[model samples]
Every structure is written in C-alpha cells, then in structure tokens.
Target: MKYLVMVQGTQADYEAMRGKASPGSPAWSEQEVQAMYAYMSAINDDLSETGEMIDGQGLAEPAHTRTVTLGDDGKAVITDGPYSETKELMAGYWLLECESLERVTEIADRITRCPQPEGAPNYPVVIRPVMEGAGDI
Candidate 1:
C-alpha cells in the first residue's frame, strides 16, 4: 500500500534554518543546514534504490501559500495563507509503497533522526495510508 510520510515545522523553524532566529527558534549555521540536506538526500536515495519511494518533495514556506475559499456570495475568494507564525505545517513528504504499517513507520523513524542543531526542536513525523481501492479507509 502507498503511504504519505510527512515532517512538520513552523515558519520559525524554516527561518531558523535560513540563518534567522526568532524568540523561540534556534538559528542554524550554513554548515548545519547543509548537513540536514545531506541527511535527507541520503534517505531519499536509499529509498529510491530500494524501490520504495514513489514521490518526495520539500514544500516552500507558508508565506508563499495562497488560499481559496468560498465567499459569502458563493464566489471563490482568494487570500494569503491562514497560517500563523507558529502554526505547524508540512515541511516535506515522501510517498512510499511499503508492505505494512511497520515498514512505513520504520522509514518515518529514520527521518526523525535526521541531523539538526543540538538544541533544535524535534518535530514528530506523520504517516497516513492512502485509500486507493474499495473499502480502504
């Protein structure tokens, strides 16, 4: 079955990785950011070679997002993102075909161990099954 494995972060986390730190976020050096990229890349490479990775991507910051919603008059209204500064959002995701929940969970576990600055917050990884066939939930 296919599963979506995701990692979440706040805007502060994104800014911190880019060398800007807010009140609750820690700043990361260029070397620190590069190390994180290297670690995530290695995982992607390994999964691809194993034929488990179907798709993967990193998302842009929430500030770049746009929202579409139904207006009171029923027309579509567009606006900037609704996320607050500290709102947690998906930072990245991997679509994987795994034999079982255990397998996907294992992959997510590996992702959670990716390199970070010593004091950086460790956010949990999320996994959800994709409903592809009848009766899937």
Candidate 2:
C-alpha cells in the first residue's frame, strides 16, 4: 500500500527558518540545526536504500502562502498568509510504498523523535492511505 506521512509544525517552528527567535523562545543553536539536518538525511537515505520512499520534501513557511476561495457571486477571493487561525501547518511530507499501515505508523513514530530544541513537544504526523484508481470511475 502507498501512504502519505505528513509532518506538522507550529508558527514557532516556521520562525526558526529565518534565524528569528520564536517569540519568547530562544533561537536554535548551530549544532542543534546541523543535528536535525543530519538526522533527516540519515532517515531519507535509509528509506531510499529500502526502496520504501516514493517522494518526500519539506515545505516553505506559511507566510509565503495564499488562500483562495469562491465568493457567492462566483468571483475568486484571495487572502494573504500567516495562516494564523490554524494551530499547525504542514511542515513536510513523505510518500511511501509500504507493506502495511503498521509499517507506515512505525516510520512516522521514528520521525517524531527527530532532533529539535529541548522542551519542544512531539508534533503529530498525519498518515493517510493513498487510494489507487481502479478504472471504474
């Protein structure tokens, strides 16, 4: 089965990208940042060797995003980012072809342990099965 593993992050995490302190939180040290990059690289390498990873990538900050909706009159309405209303933003995602849901869950669990600042809470990873078309519809 194919599954999507989505990693979420808060606004604080996004601010860290620009070398800015997350409000009251301290900035991430150089060592800490390097450690996280190394950890993610190791995981991706392992997945590639195992032939489980189909595709995966981290996303840019939500400040670069735009929200579009349809108005009652059928015009497109657009709003700028910050996405402040949302508690969590999708930070990254991994698409994997795995044996079962259990395997995917295991992968996600490992991802939660990736390096981060001390005292940071474990963020949630949303896993969903990819539906394949059967050619009926």
Q: Pick the candidate with the highest TM-score.
A: 1
Where does candidate 2 stray beyond 4 Å? 23-26, 134-137
Error of 1 at 91 (Å): 0.9
TM-score for each predicted model, relative to the true structure = 0.94, 0.89
Global local distance difference test of model 1: 0.91
- Which lDDT tens digits does candidate 2 get at residues 1-137? 89999998766776774456765444677787889889988889999999999999988877777789999999999988776586778889999999999999999998988987775556788999888877523
* Residue clash pairs of candidate 2: none
lDDT of 1 by residue, 1-137 (tens): 99999999888888899999887778999999999999999999999999999999999987777879999999999988637654788889999999999999999999999988878888899999999988884
Best candidate (score: lDDT): 1
Q: Model 1: which ten-residue window has the lowest total lDDT?
A: 79-88
Which stretches in model 1 have alpha-carbon errors above 4 Å?
A: none
